[model samples]
Target: MSQISRGLENVFIKTTALTYIDGDNGILRYGGFDIDDLVEHTSFEEVIHLMLYGDLPTKVQLQRLKTSLNEAYEIPQQVIDTIYSLPRESDAIGMMETAFSALSSIYGEMWNKNTNKETAIKLIAKASTVTANVLRAKEGKKPVIPESSDSFARSFLSASFARTPTNDEVKAMDAALILYADHEVPASTTAALVTSSTLSDMYSCVVAALAALKGPLHGGAAEEAFKQFLEIGEPERTEEWFKKKILEEKSRLMGFGHRVYKTYDPRAKIFKRYAQKLSERSNEARKYFEIALKVEELGIEKFAEKHIYPNTDFFSGVVFYSLGFPVYMFTSLFALSRTLGWTAHVIEYVEDQHRLIRPRALYIGPLKREVIPIELRG
Candidate 1:
């Protein structure tokens, strides 16, 4: 007899060199390098290179990669026209899926086996550029072009906001991107991989990933966390909010507990610092950060006994708020960064051992019975 693993909990799927996680100890690594080290010493572009190529790039290699990303950044104006045609109050995640599917329709014929890398670079750059355009279209503003001269975060912010981001704002955006770049076989990435396992194109895989990310269990934790902070309204109200939500009602603290991490999420630890540093400069951001700190403390005190702890989503929204993004854009930014990992994994899957990812399902329903004549059947 076979037993079902509900939700595929603790299932091992395939091997990867992209990322590593030790959830029990709250560790996350990309390409064998500690996340703490990456956050301190590397840029988001470097992290992207590491996830894609499995090694840190030399200065020449880095510059070449940047040139490739820059060169592939342009999208046809027809694509922008589609974005403008959508309803302005539309969901960003759905808009992303629709956009990528449209992109696949536009570029589908261009992708063959050999051009996957070029396609990957194109999709990676297009993810952010198109997302910014979607936001601009919603606002009835002209789409701003990304500047290859600036870093990816700076370029993305400038395109979305139509103004140059401050150096510090760029730094925070950079950190958020790196932190969210990949999480080993996350549902969104796996959705992309599952699509790729059948030899689908990269844009199709991206559409799959965006669809997965739109699920509540995957994408909106950080956004929900931010909403809770605003509901708490101030630092002084943090304890009351925490108690009413977590202790009194036995409800979750949204971003506090993780299915994977038994200890504090290492990414959260890093983001808390970013939130603090950034909060010092922005009064609006500072208010949310204050509530986040109190929530973290009270959450640990109340829930750590159960090995529940804050995950990466805990403070990422505070950082995003500091960088001046609207709340709806939070998960779109996640899809943008994770598209790097999605494209990378799809490439790896297509290049290696091949098989359909079909799994068996357990059946539990009515037992079969002999059929009677139609007139006699009840």
Candidate 2:
């Protein structure tokens, strides 16, 4: 019998140059650049270039990529009509998947060495537009036209909220997008790579990724983690609630632990700062931040021996909530940021190897037996 690796744990299917993770040290990097350095020095647009094209872009190259992205930001009118026609109560990420799948009508093509890169750029560029419009349609609001003059972050924010964002808000949004642009190969990335392995178009690959990301264990964790803060209500009640819901009842704490990182998620560290800074602007945000701090304090104290620390989802919801996004839209925002990573991985995998990802299962059921007659089976 073959050894069974449930969930394909610790499986290394192939090598990737996109993102690197040192789980033991809680270090993350993109295209050989340290995550901390990238977040501090580079905008989301620059990170997009780095992930797709390899090295950091020069001033001229960055400008050109930005131009290409801005040009592709406007999704087709048919896609917009599809977005408007969906039920208002539809899941945001589900709507995003549908929108990307709809892109197949126009952009879908068989694997082509010449045109694949251009298709990747278009998918990444339009992800934000698709996400923002999905949110608008959910609220029965018309789509906001993309402005080529606006930066990537500004473009999404202005359209989503129907208002121009302040410079500080734009900076925060950009950093958040940069942090989530890529992370080695999580489940969603794996799903995407699997689809791309079969030589599917980039849009179809992203749709597969989105389907995987819509699950609670993956992309929905941020929304669930933030709900814990809301449930705790007051900062002073955190201890009692932690004792009742976590310690005594043994309920799982959503954002406290990670599968890979033994220490604090480096992305979470960056998000904590943004959460703190943005929390100052809103009374509601300040209250949630306070509760989150208390929960983290207690969580670390209890789980330090286990090496289960906060992951990226810990404070990300707080930052989004602070920015006035609804709780349900959390994962959709994640999808928006992660589209770059998904497409980057898809392009790399398809262009490099293009092998189908099929693994054998260890069957443990009883050996084949003769089927009994229907009357005798009972």
Candidate 3:
């Protein structure tokens, strides 16, 4: 029998031209455009347009996309109604899961309709609204509506915090969203594609993907990594804390490595910059950023020889925290950013002559035998 690639590591199931990652060189591309190029030149909405369409938009097209996003920013009435019924302190993730699952009724008979531009737009725009609102509700605040077509990054932050974000904060948020927009074929995107292969509604497909992202081994890493910094308590204490946990305690540090990239995560490089800038946003932010930097330097010095370097989650938690999101809401931000990728892949898989994404599993068990009588003697 052939070898089983446990967890399908290094396995190729389908071909996608959506996004590309060269782990060895630490490169990422979305729709064949270099990620860094997109970050420098494009807005988050522009990046979404690039992912949904095959090219950058003209002025008219970009404006239409922005207008559509502004229009779609409103959460459907039913989803909001459901949110209002939940306890103010309810889980942000659960709120998102339940709210998205309610989409089948919003579009009514979505399984028959393959993913299109509107489907993509609604998910991308509403994800920001829904994620921000859930956090607001948890904070015992009213849901803030997004009003502008131009600056979603600013809109989301202002709405969620009930205060306008400074220019630096908006730029940081935009960069963070762009950095996280997509990553070729991740576990969650694959799960979404698998669901889409069955011709399931986009709602069900995205929810399945979100469930995969919720795993602590995946999307939950950022939240845990942030908490680790808090636990370490102070920047000067980072080395001692790391030693106590890694040497004496023999524990796993949350944010230092990734499965795909041996080199430092490219996103981490960008986020670390934002984290540094955001650290200056407030005194508390500065302290956390210092701790994050200390942990990174110590971790790389210790583990880089083994190709275990900082991954995206390493600084993402600090960046998000500096932006005023709660630790628990970290993954919600991840999910919102990643839904663009998921929505894109769903469209590509459904349109590209996809197949059911099941693979054969090896079974190692005793051969079938006849059942013994009720009381078989030993």
Candidate 4:
């Protein structure tokens, strides 16, 4: 029999306006909006609406959508308190994963088909709240539920930091959110679509996506990037540390490589500027940027053929670092943005007649082996 590719890692399985991944070229777009344009001109909520509904909303539509999202933002105090009860040092991604798992416990009775759309909207809306509250709770601050009038992006930044952000901060973070909103049906998004394909509850689908996003190589990269920064300390030490790292780690440079883009990730390009702007506010900004550029240049020179281009993670840490976000909250923030794409994909999957996503897997293990007693057979 001929070998068949099922998961189709390098093949397109479906067409979508939700996002475009030109991995070979290292470009990403959502619903016709380039990642760079969206980051420069739109809010996270606006981007979310675009992905879901296929166009940037008109003023009235944007208002109504924002209103609905804000309305759904008031999560139960029980949820907030549950997050509070987790250990302060607990991983933010793990907390989000657990909190989402527990969201079902509170809304278990509502877990049916009749409420799927409503539930998806609610999950999309409350995602920012969940992530923001977890960050606050980790710091022993009372989590702020969204105020009725706040934009989703503003409310999330305020709730997480316990103060409203400056316009510049909002723009930077909104860019970060929009940039991370989707990445062309990554593993986590695929997990979400597969779950939704089963007609599983939307909340369950989001929960499953969270599980996939918690992996070390995906959303976890930003956190790892930050950790490497801390290990490298000041800017002057960067060269020494990076050199030692390449020698000892061999093929890995933490945030320096991309799996797809051969040149540079466009998303990373935008954040590189934002991170630079943000660093100007601090004495350490120049040093950090220099270190980042050095890493990128070195990685390109050493591993360009391997597609180890500077990725989104390359500058993501610098942005979060300049903004005062804790390293561990990196993936939680990613989850909050990606909730939009997850729901959009779920909605898209629901429109299909088939509710299954069965795919063939290459089997390399013995096909007809019988069970044997370990000690006796040996």
Candidate 5:
């Protein structure tokens, strides 16, 4: 047998044209456009169109896509009720998973052998609605339905926070969403793809992705990274905290490494700029940014030799926090942005002569062991 690749590290599954990553060189591109260029030049809606349709939208196409997404933002009443019924202490991402599962029942017609762009748009739009309402229900606030006039990023932020956001805030949030829109195939995307390979409905595939993303090592990393900044408290204390917590105590840091990126994550670079820009407007945000910078400096000093540097989760928490998101809602925000990628991959895989993503496990236990009766086994 070939040497087992634990965790399937560096394993190639299938081809995709959606997103590309040159991890060794710290490059990311959606379709064929570089992420940095996209973040600077495109709206979240535009990136969604690019990912789903395989090209940037013209003015008319972009408006139609926006209208479709805006119209789809109102989730089913039953899904909202389901969100409210969950315990207040329920994990936010988990609540989203449950909500999407409930959404699948209402859109039962979507359960077919093949998925399409319309289904992808609906799931992408409703992901934000479900996530916003989940956070609102947790805070004992009523859900806010988005107006059709609102832009995609604005709709999510307004609905999530129950207030209108400033233009700068909307721009920052849009960039954040675009930066997180897709990343080739991470754990969550792979989870979605695997479920899609089984000819599952899009909603069920999203639920599966959410389940995988809830782990600390995956989508949950941003929340954990924010907690670290809060724990550090003061910028001045970062070095001592790093020494005690990370050096002497040998504690693992949450946000500084990636499985693929050998240098700084390209998304992290974009997020860091946003974090710095947003930090200037809020004292609390500034403090977190300062502490994050210090931590990044110290971390790079220690680990740069090995090519481990800040991943997307590093400064992303600070950006989310600055944008008025609670720490708990970080991963759900990830799910919202990633919905496009998940559905895109699903559509691509199913359309490209789909195959079940089943792999074999090497058996190591006693070969050909004979089963004994319960009475004799003892």
Candidate 6:
């Protein structure tokens, strides 16, 4: 039986160039390129094209895709007003969910079952717009629509702040996006696939994915890791804090441990470098860098023997924090990158409609017995 049919096993369905797992050696690959290679040598937009179209784009092809995304990066005024008027404390994930729900009302006809490939392309291109706009609105700023000629990574970063980004900021964000662009089918991606299997619209599928990614164990970790640093108070005290934290029932250091990666997370190594560069570029508080380095060192030195290593979330926290992104928006940006992978998987599923992903469950309760009347049962 296939892993999808078994349900409990990690289901790593194959693709021509995608890699799903290295359960024994702990590696991740996409399109035959190791994650480490892609992050250093490729842009996030290029990676998205690679996954979706199944090969790296030529310079001309990549430029065209960037242009399409840039054109699609504007939100309607009504959507912006709705987002800005929400209460300040509204959960970011909830904001995304509500935003998507509202979008469904506006684009009802474009997301129909019979919608053509052109409509699908627009949805894929515009996802970054809806996402970046929400983050800016929550901060009481107007969103910047992307300029058609702007680079994909720069447009996303700039749109969130409604301003053009500096060269350094764009470079850092580009690398961050590439690093996060995909990871096999995680639990949240599975949630998206399951939702899409029901023939839900693209907005709903992406919203379901955002909800799943918002939990502490998933996309929520990057922000939580920084929160932990704040609570630690001093860089020198981190090890002691960890000692105390490990004993507390309420504590688990987010971003330090990953379900995958018995060794270092391939993407983390690339992001770690960018985090350092970003720290210097922004002239960040030294404590953040100090704490991050200590955490990474300690994570490996103390926990490597036990198979715990820092994931992409740890260093990404520093990179994003230094870039002035609110911690709550960490997963939203993650959603931005991972959206490409989600669409790719959805397209693959639509192509391979061999099964609806139905799986069996083990019944562990009492054996079947005769039913009784309500009074007798009580």
The Cα local distance difference test for each model comes to 0.83, 0.88, 0.83, 0.77, 0.88, 0.72
Query: TM-score of model 4 relative to the true fold?
Result: 0.90
lDDT, candidate 4, at 317: 82
lDDT of 5: 0.88
lDDT for each residue of candidate 4 in 123-184, tens digit (9 for 90 to 100): 87778788988888888887787665446767777777877788888788888888888887
In model 3, which regions exceed 4 Å deviation? 111-115, 373-378
Q: Taking the tens digit of each residue's C-alpha lDDT, what string does model 1 give over 1-378? A: 348877777887778888889989888999889999998888888887787777888988788878887777788887887787899998888888888988998887433667777777778889878889877877779976687854888888888998888988888888888898888787888888888777777798899999998865777788888888989998999888777877889877788777778899999999999999988877878888988988888888988899988888889999988887788888888888888888877777767645678888677777797879999976
What does the lDDT come to for candidate 1? Answer: 0.83
Estimate the overall C-alpha local distance difference test score of candidate 6: 0.72
Off by over 4 Å in 2: 375-378
Each prediction's TM-score against the native? 0.95, 0.97, 0.94, 0.90, 0.97, 0.89
**What is the C-alpha lDDT profile of model 6 across 209-284, one tens digit per residue?**
8788888888888888878877777889988887778544437657876666777777777778888877775445
**Model 3 CA lDDT for position 133:** 78
Tell me which residue pairs clash in candidate 1.
none
Candidate 6 residue 343 Cα shift, in angstroms, is 0.7
Question: How much is the lDDT of residue 243 in candidate 5?
Answer: 99
Write one digit per residue (lDDT tens) for candidate 3, span 1-378.
469777778988777777888888898888888877887888888888888887888889999988888888877777877876798777778888888888655753454334476788877788888888788778888866676746889888887887778888888888888888888778888888888888887778778888888877788889888888999888888989989997679777788777789999988988988898788968888999999888888888988898989888889988899888889998889888988888888888777766777777677888787878877845
TM value for model 1: 0.95
- How many residue pairs clash in each candidate at the backbone level? 0, 0, 0, 0, 0, 0
Cα-lDDT of candidate 3: 0.83
Candidate 6 displacement at residue 342 in angstroms: 0.7
In candidate 4, position 68 carries an lDDT of 79
TM-score of 5: 0.97
List where candidate 1 sits over 4 angstroms from the true fold. Answer: 109-113, 370-378
